[model samples]
Target chain A: MTKTKKIPVSLTLASNRDKSDHLAGFLSISPWLIGFILLILGPMLASLYLSFTDYNLLSSPSWVGLANYRSLLTDARFLKSLEVTFTFVFVSVPLKLIFALALAMLFNTGRKGSSFFSAVYYIPSIIGGSVAIAVVWKQLFGRQGAVTQILSLLNITDANLIGNPDTALSVLILLVIWQFGSPMIIFLAGLRQIPIELYEAASVDGASKWRQFFNITLPMLTPVIFFNLVMQTIQGFMTFTQAYLITGGGPLDETLFYAVYLYETAFEYLRMGYASAMAWVLLIIIAVITLIFFLTSKYWVFYQSEGGR
Target chain B: MHSNKRLLSDMIFYVFVIAIGIVMIYPILWMIASSLKPATEIFNNAVSLWPSAFVWENYPSGWAGFGGIGFATYFRNSVMITSIVVVGTLLTGSIVAYGFARLEFKMKNILFACLMATIMLPIQITLIPQYIIFNEIGWVNTFYPLLLPGLMGGQPFFIFLLIQFIRGIPRELDEAAIVDGCSKLGIYWRIILPLLKPALVTVALFCFMWTWDDFLAPLIYLNDASLHTVTIALRNFMDTQGSTSWGPLLAMSSLSLLPQLLIFAFFQKHLVQGIATTGLK
Candidate 1:
């Protein structure tokens, strides 16, 4: 913290010259400051403005106020994608939390090789969102895949799992669920932070393992649970890769997620304006959901310590 | 509580947990085993726990340039992009995270909020616009677009995470440095950067894996086969019609996963910390 250029903390309040010095003090943080202006802040505001325009890259964006929004409200594909995305988040997020929580509880036994188990479980989470893993999933469930070949053992010759509309979405869901390692690992960490003596005391009080889990672990883990739920929910809503690479959002759009459809609309069809509008709506939806979660957090989220609960 | 019932419940829990683990790992294990098996042996053999032949030559065949060109060059591209992204993300993201975490500034809170806000915006809306922007800049087929975004706070999540970690460090340290006539830059360089090693390592490792595994960005930007990342290379191992020599593709994919594995193997604890502290716990 040695100064080549120092802003004196005791600068006189009576001088306009000190303000210029403070400005210089601010100028030192130019990397993030300039980046925010040039990249993120600028693009975000532009995206908002772009949402109301008819800019399709070839022509100048003419202001068409609220037209994009109006059309999107009735756009069937957009609505379908909304439903698909909602279904995805609605199903996957809760299941993810539950599975992750369960896995964490099991691993929290402080077993030997626990670290290795944790790492192994986390490996899928690392690559799960990528298109490569999704592609591997596509191949695994393809007609000539391991799953299909396994099914052929039962003489079910026509079990094309990835192609079937009924099963395709579920496959993606399973993929999402399989990557429970992120939350599971986080939950394990949270569980470790919880004092083990509480569980030991509960056992001494003759409480069963399930009772101890319900009575002790659940309440203690709520804050971590809440955080994971919000993050995973947002991530689940924005899922694109699995459906994109696997089903291509096909077999009658069963797997056509909001982001995938938005990507298809924007990139495949050059509907940047419509896509921008969709992006805004998505932003609003996510904002509202986050706001709701934050608002309700006071009611349920428990922070443990000498601090508070 | 009934002791017998409790015992039965624990037994059931263990059963349930083990069952779930098998199902969870089965597909990935299947991929590994299949990649080792010969082409004819893939389906002819039952989908069991392990592969029989363990033909390691699939790695070389797969790495050898496909269509008279192979994954050798593609692996290089993947390496290049991943390395660039790693450096870019650490350099830019740490600087920005440092700004938000330690440095006081004008509208600092507002700008940090804006960074968080970008987290939820779908990348699709930007893809075509960014693509056209890149096209106009004559960078559509170049690695610039693929690599440069990482240099910005394009990845806000890691920045936010580092900010949280930075906030955990005592400000008194910086104040002490100030008393010793240290500059703010000196505070960041000596006090903050060294202390922020765990978070920085977490950020760098995740960036490496993320950029390496990212098919979409490279898929969109690097259209030239010569410039293809591993993901695109794996895709090219197949055709539009589906089902041709995927064994080698899967084998090469197994190879592609090596970087991530190496990352995890070396930095397991930091990675665990990352998973735990990636703004959740």
Candidate 2:
């Protein structure tokens, strides 16, 4: 050693501080970094490779490049799952958002105990997809379900909604719409963020509620709308427990969501490679959808804080 | 006249809110009511709000569970797993989030972006490979596969949430502590940890609830009857081929929902704040 400790107190202190700071930072975040590599990145690469091979857990994976993807083009179940998933996403996201925003707007008028009401409304979203809830929903739509009984009171008979293929998906969609709590909460937050002065000025200028909403509220809420859109779309695609528990993808595979189908393929049928390909395709679809939104967001989404569009 | 109109509108508003709240809570209310009803009465008066006869035996029967394994075991397993996960998540999540929020290090931006991007990647895409990895390490059929990821900063959502929270805390405290010759770890341990109580509580509540409610992982990983979670135990009630006992099933489900309902009622403020804060950003 060159007797570095005796060189100078301040010099050693400053240099040692930087080293310690860097070391501490590394040590602090290293867990996540290591986890991200082993769990996320490494698995992703393996999944990509697995998509091209025919791997069952029983044996080693054997390569057959593009075969799984090619098969997907002709696979009827795969196409049906995509159709079901896309329809579910496209239909449910807007309705849920609309319902959430309407309730949020209603609550945003600053009524007494509005928070209590909002919390009550959020209960379904908290436990909507639990097996218990799903089972309860199944009973609610069964032949002698609460819905059927109510429909009977209206002089309508034999209202078997869950058993019928035509209306089963609609029942699930209704369940999704019912659990619009998070978006409702987020919308309430966004609604609060809109400046009260803008609304006051609009009213002073003799603007009607509808006109003020169109000009003021909608523009201010676009960012939150966009956020909700992306999240709800992903959630729509990932809906599994409800479909798996409620319908079990029955009545001609009407509600066989992409995720449930992929799960059956991977775990039940043990077609791991095929399922991996399906998973990748699902990922790509979401990425492209989200990318399109991001690309088009600049045109419509106004950020008043970000240089005023 | 305007004041009368406002009063009438307020009346309408209260009615509307109450009606909507009833609709929102009807299913859960129906479940509790049906749980108390006899097996025949469940379907007989499915539309009815109240049970004609209260059958308290449903709770004991449901708790007895299937094939000698009771709901007590499932509840015990859930509590054990969730407690471990919550503790591990708070520890790892706060540390990683603190690093992202406060520390200056190389690759920080890239790493942060990577963490954010992982939030978008569907868990299914990584499911197969992870299953293989867990199997390779002989962690399958054990809680290790389900529990270890949470322990090792696997939940990026919590990390992102805590990072947003940690960012909101003032840096003056850290600076003052540094001037007092505190090391980086010392500042984090002494000041940041205590200040992070609210966020930590939110994180713990969410972790516990999500783990308790989680069915898919426990389903895929734990094949043994003994290691089944509450969700899976509830699922087993449906899986048996014979005539399904709706009373016992609904009774157990109502019991299972107690924790979530209690947590929501008590932590309504924190829950609302947590979502608004993390989600809006």
Candidate 3:
């Protein structure tokens, strides 16, 4: 009888401790929980609702039932922005990845002074998104700017690259491709994670350097490549400050990125409802592209832990 | 003969690398060189990296700033916002990470997944509604819109990063603290936080750089001219005076980049490590 009474008391004490732990856990994470609801989750739901309405900041929203999305299909600038953004993402991401991978291989050779070189290469990536760089780029590609002058020295006189419709998007692409340092750093880390023994074993089997690289390095680096591809693709689609500051999405809207167009729609024109719709469309586009990447990743991406399966 | 061939290849490699490095760094050098050049020389001598004469006046003139508001004001504003945001990110990020990393509760898996999902969610989705909400609260024009987000656990990336770091720490430390009559919060403060210094430094440095370089938030929220951050002021300076004075514009631009360069120079190890770890994971 005494043992049974003691057991019930101990059970109650353990229950009380568990309740306190649950409370503490909730309390500890309350800031992020509150933020996620207020800033992300709540806002996401509100935007979804607003996307189907006609609302400006000055007045209340009126339900319109997908009119904004319908109008989007007919919007020339919206279509153009999509084309420009798609072109930018497709062209820049691969070029950036290639450069990053190649340079990472060079640095991974374990040569003296590689770290210093890496640091030097990283400066542009650090500040390339700044207005200062964009401003400088505009001047650099202007009619009498340094690049034009240098081109004239070569007797290849072309008009201001920024002002030319055909070249404007390419200029922005080149600017982004120049800042491949971050991915290169990531690639470097990934390369280091690849074991030297693989290369050694390949060499022992009388494999040529090119053969070793194709068979081992390339397959091993697929996961890192996928990560870089996904990140750079997302970033490339959202290319803004460069296009906004340098070209102002101009030369007949050839450089109009989606985010720049969205900003113009929302703040510049104050068409909050339409902009919200555009935002959802963009979210959907990113989601679809990311999903495609994940689905395709299994075919190419190699995990050593899975024993090459 | 083999040693001689190897030496020759090394020489070729160094030359090639140096040449590429020059091309990479030339634009920045040109911007700095242009800032010190005379107005006439800016365009005419654009190809030349070395100015015939250094115009010391550009610094002072740029410091004088546009419309009676100086660059000093913008710099001060940036420093204030950046410092507070850094502190807030550390505090909130650590607290939230500890909860996720150490504590067990109902729906922890779901909440954790939600945290991960937000890391990939684009800001554009929430931008409009957030603006409307803040506007309704009469907080649109104030720094509250800018400051509150940082205080409210900042970016999910930093929180995730801290969680990763916290998980690597052994649970034995926490158990010992509990045995010593420590509360959960006490264990966090006395044990986890002290052990989390390296990761905190990484988070702090990133918070400082990103907050300092942030343009969009300050652009949307701080509409008053006097309330402008360096980025906004720089853009406005270009709009009003870009064509008239390239020297001062470039000079001010260079000034705006100084803090970033200084941090990169000093804390490069932390920055590189942060990127590598995040990418690998």
Please count the clashing residue pairs in each candidate, in the order shown: 10, 0, 0
* Poorly placed runs, candidate 2 (over 4 Å): A1-15, A155-159, A307-309
Sort the predicted structures by TM-score, highest score first: 3, 2, 1
lDDT of 3 by residue, B71-147 (tens): 99999998889998999999998999999999877899999999999888888899999999998999977888889
Candidate 2 C-alpha lDDT tens digits along A1-309 = 656656688778877876777788888998899889998999999999999999998899999999999999999999999999999999999999999999999999998989989988888888887888987898888778898789878986567888888888988999999998889999999999999999999999999999999999999999999999999898888888899988889779999999999999999999999999999999999999999999999999999879664
- Docking quality tier of candidate 1? acceptable
Ranking by lDDT: 3, 2, 1
For model 3, the docking class works out as medium
Model 1 C-alpha lDDT per residue in residues A189-295, reported as the tens digit of each score: 88888887898899889999789888888889898988898888888877776788888887788888988888887777877777888887887788799899999
Q: Relative to the unseen true structure, what is the C-alpha lDDT of residue A219 in candidate 1, on a scale of 0 to 100?
A: 85
True-vs-predicted CA distance for residue B20, candidate 2, Å: 1.5
State the C-alpha lDDT per candidate.
Answer: 0.76, 0.89, 0.89
Better of 2 and 3 by TM-score: 3
* Cα displacement (Å) at residue A161, model 2: 1.6
Off by over 4 Å in 3: A1-7
Residues A122-237, model 3: lDDT tens digits: 88888888888887898898879999899888987686888899898988998998898899999999999998999999999999989988899999999989899988888777
The model with the greatest lDDT is 3
Worst 10 residues of 1 chain B by lDDT: B238-247
lDDT of 3 at B43: 90
